[model samples]
Target: MKLQVVLVLCAAFALSLQAPSSQECWCELQSEEKAFPHAKLSMVERNVSDCNRNVTPKKTLELESLVLGLDRRIALLHRDISVLEKEDDGELYGVLSLYVVENEMVEIQQMMDKLNRTMKGDQHLTADVTQQLTELQAEMGEMETFDTMELVKGRLATQLLKKDLDNCRKSLNATVPPTQPPQGTCPHGQLVNVTGPQVFTGGEYPGSYLYGAWGRDPEPEPGKENWYWLVMMTVSNRYSNYVRLYSSLSALIVGKSVPGNIIIHSSNPTTNTIQGPNNVLYRGALYYNCYNQLDVCRFNLTTNTVSSFELPKGTRYNSKGNFCNLDECYPYTDLDLATDESGVWVTYTTNQDFGNLVLSKVEEGEPPRLGQTWHTAVYKQALTNTFMACGVLYGTRFVSKDVEEIFYALDTVTGKERFNVGIFMNKMAPNIQALNYSPVDRMLHAYSNSNMVSYKVWFE
Candidate 1:
């Protein structure tokens, strides 16, 4: 019995000895187990220690970089905001400003990504790092709110600026110079300025001159007030069909006359002719259309050289399917040319049963090209019409058509017709042969067989 009890005691002692110390057993169990039961606690302890040892320095460096990046972004945002504030409504500045906010969002997301990667590496750091990340997310959300507010503010400000600009334009347009009586004392029988005959003189009419026409001078020369230059188209009236060019100061005609300077002459007589001289000054160059050959030419007064370009061969000049010809049977006459800050535009008529309006753009670059060609719907009611005018290009609401004897404020770019002034129909009796705009006076001048009249135009 004594031996058995001793044996049992010894066995108990041996079993106890075989077992590890508490800390040792804990470590051993961790090694033996498929998964450590105290894995989270172990990670927590190690992370705590590492945090104490390295987090301060690492966080300091990270914050420095983050702050630097944020400062740069903030500065950029401020600059963009300033720009947005100054631009008109619908200006791309606002969109560009929004890009700054987007960049910030991207940066924040990248920071979050980095934070997430850091958290993944250390399980114990997850909660604390997640909390910090959440705080950053909240800050980002606040930034988003700020961004949205700024965008709204910028949009509102831009709208207001545009409105102000428009109002100023209208006010300026509505302003007119005080009216004055007709110049020069009148004799009894006929109106003093009414009975002048068409005159032509020397070194003037080149033999090549075919069709010569002129527009009313809106703002006349200072001393020779009521004077405007006439744009003359002269083709080799005899043979070769080669065309030449001329212009005349309306007040200075001596005989059946023409102007000097071969502004544009045809090189390939078989293929081209100076079609129509719709004289226009654009970007410091004089541009006109050559009707017969479907070409446009630019004469640089400064350079004393002419550069020519052609339109798409298939462009519909007038609705009548009259592509390019000078004969009356063709149903269209290429008449008017105008330009704005953006580019040059030309207007021509189609000889179809119903008169059609054709508008085209001149392209840019080393050598210019013809761009989009568009045509207006048939104006069957306005038949026998021979004149049209583009008074303003941008921020303006007016175009002049002679048939209705009205000034229509139409969106020439978009072809949206606006208000029309119907007061001038009675004045249309004699027919307005030429229409022109004077930038100096901001007026539309109409030339009839007998007289030249001016109308004030307003724009916004």
Candidate 2:
């Protein structure tokens, strides 16, 4: 009886020695699989694992898309807040704009709440939101802290939102417009002040597709001079592969137009995919920043052939650089294609140039190549849009809801630069998303505030 009891006690001691330590044990699927493999499988309830769901490829992509959408909304929110700040004196839109702001603030809060709910299922994504994100969210949620009068008189709440939105831009890498310029002295002479919002046409897709370009071709085939073209950023406000055509300004205004839905290499991103609103129709072809690559793509309407040439290696692409001011960073505006009295030109900023505007001619050829390049002293982030007119590169900034200042200019001919061009563009919109100069009409076509607005450029 004594011997039997000693044997049983020794067996129990051996089992305890072999078992895992309570403090160090973890519930990994791989670790569990390796456990007790020689013994009969223990009955498990097989509950769905939070860890497995979080690691799924589909779920990961969904989270990333959600994050990007939130980032973009935050930017737009900041832009609206800026508009409210401008209108606080009851000068622009009166207190009506305040109602719009309040409504948008509520929508943004709903987005945050959705994100937080989705994050509860994802531990890894929660880490990405971080302490700073939480703080920014809290700051944004304090919209009700101010009463109507306090909010109207002072911009304290708006200022906090602006600061937090800027932080969001930094977190999402919001960095920073187009043109093929002419040669030597342009035919129209030096571009002077741009006057009037001459025409405002909100097309069929108006109040939507807010980011896009609209202008006549600088060098159209004989009978096509009357044609005005528009390419809305239909995909996530970042990509478009087709052009819509209106026979004339009147036709465009009346929304009588043909769909130029001709695919210019829709399958090949490196070829003719338009990535930003900074694209233009020049000399019977559409030139734009190639989607997903740092290259200039020219899609010849005549041949229907798409050809592209790579930009300078270090040249920024994919929204790494953008036209940004206090309110907003225009999305995916890394490469701008513009036309002038001379010919085709492209503009961008490079790390080597340190965010200053770098201008290069998209040299006209079998496959358009980059030509004589110039670097300017003006910071790209300071301006909202840029266009090349008469061989001179002009830049504009948001002055107010009623005025946009042509605050910077670079005479590519003389290599002369100025920070205060002071040539103001009379505004019809709060923000100019796309600005293109047409040598054909001697006008600047601006896609602003969900409306197609054009300004007559006075030239010396």
Candidate 3:
């Protein structure tokens, strides 16, 4: 019988060494690092890139719905906690209820943290969505529940999320996506605005009137004074069809459409003019406004070929009338591209962003893309023109012709705005539309009425 029992025990041990006969297994309960199927992490990363580039209304609505639900739930929980604390009667049951409240608060905080992470850096938020986020942040700030909240002082997570949301929305809304705006032709007639003042060629200003200039100040040279100028002649009451180019020292046209000639025939051909008169000459190409959109026409000096790069959407570019802020309304010269020590930068406003200025570093290619961006508190409509000098963005407002001033300057390094530049403009041309600064000589160039003038800027 003992021998039989030993044999039975050996048989059972042999069975255990083999695969389990029962369906239930301990291996199934073990955790897996990658629980998701079909390369979910990679797919999520791609989706984030796509969302940044362009946002669909459906996706926007879905996110908004989620945020709204979380907001409502948080509010309700906060109210319940407030009531529980108020009705406390110092009993054991009351203390136990408080413990339960604390547990609920912890759970709610976790959900909030997850929701905030999802929505914070998303670029799909619209003006309405932004308003909702602001309200949610305010509510979170008012609630005091966890020790971490007090240790950090206020709702730090909410504040960071607010900032991320604001920047993402601003940068995303700043441009018409590469896929959206029409190609081959401009959608909004002319690209530039002509309401400021008509450029006069012969009436009071008699010489070859300079509308724009780019490059260094003219120095005494034998034959190679390479500075360029855009000379204009007023043709009719509402339009000018001919624009000339000349070397500042040689007075020879540098732009040629014909094989041997020095002029390129260009016309607005529509009621809308260039978005902003401010233009930049980098390397050997000239970058200027193409249409009401943020698209910039690049005119090559060597090949005389004109190609366009679509820029980010601008504020009030499609507005039927003017943009009105808290102060006064002004015509939208909605997009401005300038050059400084670092490289090129574009400044514009978006209607959905409450007319705030969005500044971005311009990366060049077949189609341009915006790089690091800084959103400013100053309204684009408030400034007549903006330019970058020595890696700083300076905005000018035309109080009057004689009262043009550097109202605001943004430091790109620190992303801070300063109002105390103290440099003032005296006797500025009437209705000046563009202002650009040259780092070569530290002179500010002004384009007004079809006349270009340079001013000496002294830094004390």
Candidate 4:
């Protein structure tokens, strides 16, 4: 009986050893199958890279959806393996019996160890792949963000360019002169029907002319049509007032109530009287001080009275300054006046030592005061001379060691600058001085002092 029992135990042990071989065969087959999915995953990674390189947005989206589906399938496979590990079977009992069981146990232990190592290796590989994918996705997201921002900026730039182009077109269209005048025309020499606020060339009587006069001839004669009213100003003097009138033949002094002039100095060569102009259209108006003692005066055109204003201050003309040419000297000129529908603006230059270009504005109110002030630094050594022409101010300054000319529109009330419509005409010439704007024709007229050459400027 004892021998039979021992024999039975021995047989049982042998069966246990054989069972593991079968189990191992199955595990190996499953592992091999699992490797197919891993290989497919690798191929998928390659395909993703290729798609990223060559596919359109629609195709890329499709491929990403496929990848997500693959991920779901992989998760289901892991779930299956977890379920199998939880099951128990009697056949597995034979695999655990002693002698053959011992041998089988050692083999199974070795297999388990190897399986653990393989699983650990797989986990490491999965972690590495997941990290790589995450990084790639983040990089792609950043690229998309950059692309979006660039698109917006490009659109904004295009819009701005379009607006500027439209403005240029409008300016050009307005420059064309009228073809004919009213049916009945007056003789050229005689005062033509005193046109609506017409601007003409005429003479030099300080107080009589509200707008100043410029000499039409190099050497003006007493009554030889040598001067003209280029612009309107608020001050006037009997002989050297700030305003004057002009016609084609000659300039004359016409007394009018000037609207926006703040007199800084008034002396009679010896005992000059500094009292303000009496019964002026813009008298007692509020204004802001600009460069030097110059101030900007605002007035209501409808009421024929002044309001309040502000302007830039500190710009002054220096007699002993560097020269662009022998004829042009430094501290070219001080603040000139300009006005727009909104308020007043001024542009001025500091002395060569300060090396700055200044612009200022005045707000509309009871007491005129300066508003925002802006300044640009300039090179002292490159300073050049400047001048005012046809009531429009123009100047020359050095840019990159080359003389660059600039132009500005003045605010008649505030002495600030009008940012729009101001242009630099250097390409036209350097010696140009006279400038005039025709309201009806919207043309900018420019001329040289000594030459008969005249230019009509319109936007291109």
Candidate 5:
């Protein structure tokens, strides 16, 4: 009905453009420069009684039906794109992206064929219908090229990631033990459960810097055991070149008395600088994803030195695979750096794993390197956030605006997983952007929205 109305208006406007009957007098309204396919407007003539009539041209009604068919096809095409957009398993225009696009193209061709058949031998086709058909043919010509280039790139990424997956499997001749630390290193018993936010602090920059990570170092390098570190994305909420060090929890909350500041030289993304919000301060060094690359960079605050090692090939980075719930995704969170009672670890996903979180130990060495890597069945983007506790990789998803639940866990020792862990985490803010646990305080620190929240963990 709406389409018919639109067609009526256009037909009336077009008809009124004809030369006025010299004998007729018609009312006039505002004129000149109307919208769409028309450069100017003029007074249109219509019988005063035509406004009250319910009559419409048969040709306009026919055009309405044809346009309505096109509308339905356009709607279906939009829904197909939405399905490709909303998946957390991986990125759009990835593995299945090209296939979906190609299928739509085929459907479009079928629509064109049917339209051509219907118009055959109909020499009196309206100009509007002819215009729409010409546009469709032009668009189809452009789409044929899209089907080839993107598919080639997608296949290349898959092949590279497959090689990396094979390398990861070969490196793990033995299981990566649950405990990477030495005997009695973690006096805290196994992390059995986590409680709600015990303390919520909105530092000076509350709500100003949305994407960031803050927590205590489970193991300190020397005299910085009591210090708290914060690293927030400064450039586009995706890149940072410095970290703010607070002496105590109170100092962090106050946002003042911050004398400790470690700056990573060369903020340029192509250099050795911070890239994502998934960074953690561990043993006087900050571990984070390096800028514009697939490498984990370790910046030692005490020594003021930087070391980095490349991540597995085809590992998603640069906002490709991020921490996301159904509603939204935290940008540049492709590589998550975390610390547990056992040791520091990094979690990410690749094409090979189909977006499942992959855990690799960030071993402390002269030139920091990746140690044993373990794979989990939990999809990386499916969950809101993840953390390592006592060699167990735990993932959380949104239960509510103020609540997040740890529903997935993978034990590195036995290579076993549990998907039914019912521990729930309540927060002061709506989203948990970054989460890490500190063995020293036995508290889970989270960067929520623009606030810092801590939760107490209970061990069985």
Candidate 6:
């Protein structure tokens, strides 16, 4: 009898020794899988047998312990899942890491499903499982469109993050009370103050320019006002070999370059010109329309980050056709992206709209995005270029090269239009290809046939 009792006690001791430690049972992800393209199976610490924990009857110690284990395990599981969520540059098997997260999400979803089935009848267990299920469902939904890059991929990602945080907030609101405050908060947009028919007979800029000699002082934040950027290409026949930026129009004579190069992609940086008259400068980035105006690109001067967003569907890019007035079409000027007090704006006519100018807010983000859109009664084909200022959109027609600025303004605020603004270009080429107004110094910068001209505005 004594020997049998001793044998039974030893058996119980051995079983207790075989149980898993908390770290091992929590199924944390291994260090090796921390890199991109992590496999679904390798992410969790446990294998199939360990993951399929046996269930026990209600009111029993085993059942209570099982529920506690699941709760703790899920808490740890979230930490492992977050490793995949916080990065944008990670890829798996040449695919975005978002897919890897999706795969692992499915695995956890299955585990949650299994637990729900095992604890089906109990009210206490069901509530806990349902809450986790709600969270998992929300997270899974976010990953579905995780790679979508319309407008701005970063903005959409931010929205998803906001949604996730809101869901958590709702849960917290249900349990914990409120703590009051937290804050926070394009296109050839509009044209303004058209002055000038003055002529710079001297070599204002020395390039047989291929259509681009645009200039703007950096935006008027505390330190950036004194610096100006003027872009020009030396060769005009095909594309320029070099796209140069000078401190000012006169600064071009001295031949000084900006500190770092503005690397152009989507087209030949050295060869292809930025494709519109209405490129803009905001914050530290230069926003331009490219790919024949089918796309809008943002180049960050400070970070050197270049991101591009496609224009609306059925918009004419490539300037295969011209942006024409009733009399003639201007070559290579179909899409207009400009900046003003608001930020950035884009002007393009879509085939769906039957070539009517559709103006939209070009917002800044990972790639930039389209915001509120306003359609104009004016036919886009009738305008050569468009710009934005204050809360208005100003459009230009292709008058003769010798003519100064002839423009019309559309108040986006009131949905009103004013014709014959009578802005003129002086000391510049009669064939003005680009025009932008800077709110910073309140000057109009014009790019005409490879020449850079700056005019001070007397806004009436």
After TM-score superposition, what is the CA distance of residue 243 in candidate 3 from its true location, in Å? Answer: 5.9
The C-alpha TM-scores of every prediction are 0.37, 0.60, 0.46, 0.30, 0.59, 0.51
> Model 1: per-residue lDDT, tens digit, 14-60?
99899975765333334432432355445555655654665454454
lDDT at 101, model 4: 36
Candidate 2 regions with alpha-carbon error over 4 angstroms: 1-182, 265-271
Name the weakest run of 10 consecutive residues (lDDT summed) in model 1: 187-196
What is the per-residue lDDT of model 6 for residues 312-364, given as tens digits with 9 covering 90 to 100? 77877766434565555656566676766666777777788777778888766
Please identify model 6 stretches exceeding 4 Å from their true place.
1-193, 197-207, 217-223, 233-243, 265-277, 325-328, 422-427
Against the correct fold, how does model 1 do in TM-score?
0.37
Rank list by TM-score: 2, 5, 6, 3, 1, 4
lDDT of each: 0.44, 0.77, 0.54, 0.37, 0.77, 0.58
Clashing pairs in 5: none
At residue 74, what lDDT does model 6 achieve?
Answer: 58
Lowest lDDT block of 10, candidate 6: 180-189
Query: What global local distance difference test value does model 4 have?
Result: 0.37
TM-score of 5: 0.59
- Candidate 3 lDDT tens digits, 254-287: 2331222222335553322333345666655556
Model 2 weakest 10-residue run by lDDT: 39-48
lDDT of 2 at 193: 56
Q: How close to the true structure is residue 304 of candidate 6, measured as C-alpha lDDT?
A: 61
Expressed as tens digits, the lDDT of each residue in 1-460 for candidate 2 is 9999999999999998999668776575543222332221111112123334435555654565566556656767788888777665646575777778788888888888888877786765557445435654565345334343565436877888999999998979854313433355776556655656568778767788879998988778898879988888887888888878878888888888764466765553334588988988987789888888898888887788888899887888889999987877988999888888778788899999999889987778887788999988888888898998878888888888767898888887689898867876666568899899887778889998679998777666
lDDT of 3 at 251: 41
